[model samples]
Target: MQFKKYRPYERVENIQRDWPNNHITQAPIYCSVDLRDGNQALVNPLGIEQKLEYFNTLVKMGFKQIEVSYPSASETDFGFTRMLIEDNLVPDDVAIQILIPAKKEWIKRSVEAMQGVKNGIFHLYNPTNEFQRRVVFNKSDEEIMNMAVESMQYLVELTQEFQGNVTYQYSPESFSQTQLDFALTICNKVIDVVNPTTDKKMIINLPNTLEACTANVYADRIEWMSKRLNKREAVILSVHPHNDRGTSVASAELAVLAGAQKVEGTLFGNGERAGNLDVVNFAFNIYSQGVDPKLDLSMIDEVKAMYEKQTQLQVHPRHPFVGDMIFTAFSGGHQDAIKKGLDYYRKEHCQEWNVPYLPIDPKDIKRGYEKVIRVNSQSGKGGVAFIISEFLGEELSKEEAIAFGHMVKQKSDEVQRELSKEEIIALYQNSNRV
Candidate 1:
């Protein structure tokens, strides 16, 4: 591998950084882009019916904003948008968003597709990085700025003819790679033309089209832009981070501390390349810290099942928050600590969740305690006692638990695997101690 082929990203300097001391005190506005960003990345994209199903699931999960489709890009996307409008499936509080390139014909088609929807966000994007300017579009800075300004003007004019409430969202694609000065200039120009008021605020989404630097650098950029954008109070600072470098979650969190008010992501980080930030992971991170995530994730299992069925993508068993074995304990030490914590939690009747090795209460997400501890070759007395107490309603003293633990360890070693709860129960039931 030629390690010298890559160049380091430029670092932000000379700015009085405040994000380091700041903390996220509230949940940001979450927008699920599962239907558009996540669906487009699939090898076989979802059909209209499947898209509708996913859309309904997101609405029920308490997402107030959802990017439903890109209407001008595909017939399936357009049809799905129409189906939601025609069937009146969208809730009164939900805002359905659609993405479109900053072009005349495409913007017109997007507007037409959203004719009957009550609440809509028309998302416009154009590539603004130096590479895209020199290599992709081959346009000068003045020309690129003109393109964004003209697109915003056209969108503003078209909204008057449409019958629903329409909000404007703009993204300078590849924003993490764009020069900070140029990115801010283009956004300010677009904002000037849009003339957003306090009552009707615009959204300026800074997307990490590709993760180009460390999470702190992204936070620095966000803070710089938030502080410099024209009419800061009249615009909602938003972020859409992709996980090319596996740091999208950190970037999103720091961006919030840096003054971002909105986040756009998929359910399980499913998107192009490494995918977008996982909204479930981000929200649950907040939930674990005693802050309300503002999303009803109690039915996480059902949500994961529907997502897999529609996307044909399996969730990793160790994925955070929704993974099957995320809260399970196997090591003897960990099992002992968790068992004691659970016992203390029940004995004290505590309202706050505090358990060793478990960040959040599994019951909060509809997970049961049945699989919290499993016996294996590394089994210990605490786990054996836990299994006996939980399954058979019996507790063993320290001596008995220790002796039985050794037997279970031997059995597990002979099988070279973890022992199931039922197998452990049978072994205990057949034991001379029983």
Candidate 2:
């Protein structure tokens, strides 16, 4: 497989690292790029009607910022932007972000698309990584820097013509791969030109674009940039991590601890390639840790249904948080422990959740306890006893439970599959031991 052909990513050195000791005490500002990043990656992108439906879902789910589309990219994108504005579909508190390239024509069209919106973020991006600059654009360092600076200047001028409140967002498209010093240089240059104040802050988004390194490296880069950027308080440090390395969630978490205040991701990590960071997974992780994610995810099933319908993409059954099996337990020992924990929890009337095997209460996200345990060949007496007690409203003696457990195990082995609760109940009803 030529495994040795690939070289490891360079590690950050000589930096006083602090993110390892830091904890994310609060949720970051979440911006769903589902309509743009997620939609574009689909085999069939959503039409305007479907886009509106998804946008409404995101708004209801409590997102303050949503990247609707790249207006200048296509007619559909442009029309969606105007639809949200002219139709007054955007809520007063929500900001609709439109992506634009550093090109002048695209920026002009994007500005036109945002004409009457109350709150908008005009996002401008240019590739700055050495590979992209040399291979893709064949431009020198000065050329790339000038492109970003000039684009910001032009965007500032065009935004002044609009009547709506417009915020500026700049992404060094492949910031994770770009030289840290050069990345800082370009971002500071844009900030200098934009002259953002505390009242109106600009966003500097450091995107992992390809998720090239380990999560710790991403955190190191974020902390390094956060500490060094000029007018740091006047700029919101943001991260847009991709999942090429399957660590976007970890990278995003560490980045937040490192000082990023905004996160740009899709609902369930839908995007190009492996996909963008899964915002739902990231938020639920925080929620499990006792921090309020500030989003109502209690209707996760409904959200997943709409997302799959619109994008024509399926959420993996094993996907974290919203996955079907996330809260399900099949291991006999695990099921037994969970049963004991629930019993203890109810008897103590505990204010804090400390249930075994469950990080956060399943009911908190509108999931039921019906599937928490499933009988299999490895089934034990306690799990079988609990199932009988809960489903049949009958208590089994210790000896009876042990006898039934052996029978259930035999049945499961014969079928070579996990037994449903109904199947187990039927077996119990027909058993001579019963």
Candidate 3:
């Protein structure tokens, strides 16, 4: 009965859905929403100092656009926005963005916060979902449309007096749940009001505020709108995917294939409920495909450490690319294949990365190969031998390795746990009576 109460996601009817055949060969224009989206979800949100530190890290990572805060919502957010400007902490190349509701009082206050900003974005959002329209606001279609139009009109008027280069961005909150036609209409209408040119483009961010469908279906919706939206050439089409369905990464990848030019997400997928899209995970996905993601991820461990320190959130040990156990192999068959693959790679001097069980080299992200093999009762002889040879750097014949492997497995079994590298080495010395 609980399952029956939920309605199925309506499939987008498109015979020419090209995203399935398309591949993402390049990185999207990434906008990190870590401070706004990621920070809001944290149990202990970062203070100004922490936020500034995080912002600097994003800049160092080569993020061009970062949504810093919802300025009008709180005193702290407003102060942070001013500090970045008055303190001159923002770089000329980076554009610091602040979110604001489509309301005049908030917009006016947001404009005040953004004063003296060199390059900035005034992000406006309003819920456009059916439930919000019919029940929450109790407003008709025309009324809702007018609110967005008038807000854009007022926002433009307020920002015109400012000296900085300003870019406008709009998000139809809960965009994935809105009717495809209405979503397109609302976005196009906002574009018409802004009248963005090729030199100065407006961002239309379609957020999966509440993910309701499979990744492919979301791609179809994006493609459908991308094909039909007006002033398309002057608009930077973006997608902000939330990880409600545990498919935010897949959804973002498909959205890019479907014609999205920009992606708004947080590092490590930190956000409300499940989380936002993990930018590092998505970026490295491109890196794994032999494309440069443009972000400096070579020091991922350092970044992870900083993120954990600021947010007090521990990254899952099995998280892709930066995880502790991602490159590890405890299985005998896997260990054997990986060892063989690495050996072949070094022997053949291959240009392409084609190692078995490892996608990109761990060294590419500054991770060492020492932890790739660990010994336990479940591990095979090949794994134990691989660890001995790789970690201990002991030269052993196949026969000697097998003999040593048998000893390691028995010790691990006797201990009823994984054998540490030190313990394994000790076992090896005892086996040889060395």
Candidate 4:
């Protein structure tokens, strides 16, 4: 957990006073979509070499399960899958996942991608919604249901004959748009037909691919399905949410609270429309709440680099915990608090010296950022006065603040700068910092 443990302190630092966590569960098991969703987002799709590099990078970063690619789409995709299987680069505990539609041809191609593998996940799904059926494919519910059944039937046949390598999986593609009861009935029926048990390990992924509804309602449906889906103990309940309405992260989080065990999304919210749930944000969220997110987040930079290579888009420095702005404090008062907090932390135990300077230390995750205690247009005397007195190893009085205000004005006009209190202090702090 990134947060500090409760101790016998006289003061109770209430985090809720600043930013409350109304969420019951902080994080879920992350299945990064950097390879599939991030790659697909780019105008120039990542090449085989680029894709392979990223694929290996995420695995190295300790992502045990990842959505590698969409097989049954093109030869380039097929080649990548073949390379993932042929190169034997997949780790023992790692499950290389592939997405396929609920069609016989697509299912076969998806299974073909699974050949000669050790332990891999085959994520098979079909459109079980009204809009997708009417607009995307123009298929009726009966037709869609038949396709689902037939595809699942073939998948069952294939998985049975398949070796110790393959694992069975399915998702009700665009499940959020489908009627809840119909989706549940279809999902339950598929479970009955497949009858995947502990011995024959399986997973059912219910993807909230479109953020068309409220998170609570979606979570209710997920919980209802998870509870009613008559499966043995070993079945893994997974969730994949798309952020069309900016509710994907909440939906994904609430799913775990509602009994989901696995989650799928792209790094930094890269996806087709608005985007997917950001796995990094999701991970740090839960870690702050005292739960193990099961991610080696120290390799966040490497994962981000791979994402950039896969999609030529620079990572936003101000995105979140990994963002450049995450650890920075622009306000002079804030910076002074941070500086004092660090100073006190150096001489005193953090538990003893309670301060609200930061949520988590920047260095804990290897980020090279400090509190920005600078004088700027929006700066004030409290900030400037603090920096001034501290740098000189003496306390600057109210009298000094008035005198320093002149020096601040002089420097501001000279440098064509705005001397915030801290900036003014830095400029004339006993000439040591200056």
Candidate 5:
């Protein structure tokens, strides 16, 4: 492989960036694109029943905006949209978003699918990156701008005759790769066509469709565009960052700090390639920082179970918040510190979470304290003592704990697996007899 063939992505220069100094004090508007972006990437896309169930789950979890599907692309997608509208499955507060390319026929088809919807966001997108323009479409800059403008104009015209509350959203697709000026210019033109009023706002989604650069660059670009965009009050600046560079969450957070008011993502970052930003991870990150994320993720395990079952995908054991092993401690030092911290927390009747290794208490997310410390060959005396106290309801003296920890380590090494609660208790009983 010729590793030297690739050049670094260009940097945004000559900007007085303020996102670095600013903090994300509040939650951004979250739009789950699981049914569209996440479904498209799945080996077996979600059936209508699964989609319906997932939609209901998302609503229950406090999502007000959901990009349900690209209705023009498939019969299933179109049918799902129709079912939601006809069955009155969509809630009054939730806005269902539909993704369609910025083309005449597709726009018409998307609009047709959204007929009778109470609240809908007609999301239009077209790739405007330099490579896509020069090589793929062979269109000039003016031609690209005209495509977005014409489509926005047509959508505005169609919505006038439509019988629903319609919201408009435009994405300069691959905004991360596109020149920042062109991205801003195209969004501004689309805004002009939409002519949004103060009461109603249009969404301009700047997506890192390929996630080409570092997160800081994306934040810089978002801030730069936000500062220059026309009719700022009448527009909702949104971001949809992919995890190609494994920093989608960081990019989204930084973007929010920079000026993005909304974020579009999937539940577990399930999308093409590395995936979209994990909304669960993002929300919980805020929750840990003492902010209300506005999403009801308290029963995260149930959500993970449903997502895994429907998507036929496993959440990685180390996945930020919802993964199986995220709260588990197997390392000796970590276990010891966690045990001390947890003990201090309980003894002090602390109101704020200040455990050493555990960020937010496992109990906060309905995860019990059972697996927080597990005994293994690497387990320390503190961990063994914790396990005994947790599972067997017995307190051990310091010397007894030290001796028992050695015996547990030897047994674990001999068995070449972690010991169970019963086995640890049996060992404790046997040692007492001796």
Candidate 6:
């Protein structure tokens, strides 16, 4: 007798209702810190022209705000921020922001760099958790919080004193690990100290510097905090998550759903350690769901390329969407279903619209038809036939399909990688051309 598979205990109706959605339609803002946070984490950051090119690329992709660099960190960072001024490449619509730790000296230099650019914001952050306070500074909680409060007040006063169109944002670094009530208390005190204007919203970016917990647990805390927040003069809750646990993007999505509005991340999740949350994945997630994510993400492949060239860091083929196999299916069953699905879908939807099975046809991205199908031990007959049709302009018979499939399996044992369309054609010609 055969045993039946175990059924899930969760309510199917609720699962359908509350299940995770790709945040495609959500109107959340995209803020890429590629030049600053992502670059700092890299083994080799971008040069002046590379930085300029990357910054311009981000702006073209519809990012209105970018964390360029903190001038105080190094002469290199300082000069790059200055190049934006000398070249006048800073867009009127886009605002450049800088990252300065919650220290007086760094704040001083960061403020100094803002002298030339008229439209710029300053994001001041400090380590507030017990671990950082204890390990890094060997200071008490009272001392650290007091320093943070004073730091925000100092930053606010500094910006006002300088007479500029600046906005203030502060993050409780490594915030996800902090206690619920303690984090709330610090956030409140920081906001009160900053006292931002209504027209210019104050952002309190709470970073999961390292993703240390589940998304829902973090969501619950954020929801609880948003309702409790007092100084509501246009406060934007922000999230910056690192991928230590490989759940940064999930946590960011849940946190946004929980209450956070603005998101801070790298474009392709390039950063120190395990890396930062991928805003492309996070942004497209919202886009594919039919919501306006407020980003022109069509040039994502270019962004990934620039990043790889600049940082000398390669993107994994398994990287979502822009990766190698995102739109390609190799499994026999998957290929069969996808082939039939496309045929049926094309009849109904406009030719401009992509089928539901694939987020995008690889050809749309200029990847060409040659690499679309790779026949291997795992790939099915439908996949082989689809590849054959792409190259030859006609369909293959079931018998012809099987004949080709056996050749693929035999060839698979010979070469390590899956056979390309060209190789398959060469094999077919070698045997049948005779």
TM-score list, all predictions: 0.99, 0.98, 0.98, 0.84, 0.98, 0.87
- Tens digits of lDDT, candidate 1, 221-321: 99999999999999999999999999999999999999999999999999999999999999999988988899998988999999999999999989997
lDDT score of model 4?
A: 0.72
Supply candidate 4's per-residue lDDT for 342: 66
* 1-434 per-residue lDDT for model 4 (tens digits): 74566332122222112112235443455677777876777788888998888777777767888888888886777888889778887778887888888878888887887787777777778888878888998988778777777788888787666554676678888887777667877777677777777887578888887777767676777777776687746578888899987888888777777777888887788888888888878887776666676777777776777677668777787787776566656564675576667667766766543445555656557764323455554444545555555565555666665466456656665777655445554467465432
Clashing pairs in 4: 26-286, 27-286, 317-324, 375-420, 375-423, 384-421, 384-422
Task: Give all candidates' CA lDDT scores.
Answer: 0.93, 0.92, 0.89, 0.72, 0.92, 0.77
lDDT tens readout by residue for model 2, 257-341: 8999999999999999999999999999999898999788898899999998888888898788788888778777887798889
User: lDDT tens string, model 5, 1-434?
Assistant: 99799989898899999999998889999999999999999999999999999998999999999999999999999999999999999999999999989899999999999999999999999999999999999999999999999999998888897777889999999888899888989999999998888898899999999998899998999999999999999999999999999999999999999999999999989999999999999999999999999998887888888999999999999988888888998888998889889888999999999998888899878889988888889887888888888877778888888888899999999999998767888888888722
- In candidate 1, stretches whose alpha carbon ends up further than 4 angstroms from where it belongs are none
Q: Where does candidate 3 clash, by residue pair?
A: none
lDDT of model 3, residue 159 = 86
lDDT of 3 by residue, 1-434 (tens): 58998989999874488888998888999999999999999898889999999999999999999999999887888899999999999999999999999888999999999999999998998899888999999999888888888899899988887788999999888898899888888888898999999999999999999988999999999999888877889889999999999999999999999999999999899999999999999999999998889899997888999999999999999999988899998887888788888878988999999989998899988887888888787777677666667877766677776777777788888879998878887777776532
* Stretches > 4 Å off in candidate 5: none
Tens-digit lDDT track of model 6 for 30-90: 6888889898887776777888888988998899889999789888788889888667888
How far off is residue 398 in model 5, in Å? 1.4
Worst 10 residues of 4 by lDDT: 10-19
Q: Which one wins on lDDT?
A: 1
Give me the runs in candidate 6 sitting further than 4 Å from their true place.
1-24, 161-164, 350-357, 363-369, 411-417, 426-434
Rank candidates, lDDT, best first.
1, 5, 2, 3, 6, 4
How many backbone collisions does model 4 have?
7
Tell how far residue 152 is off in model 2, in angstroms: 0.8
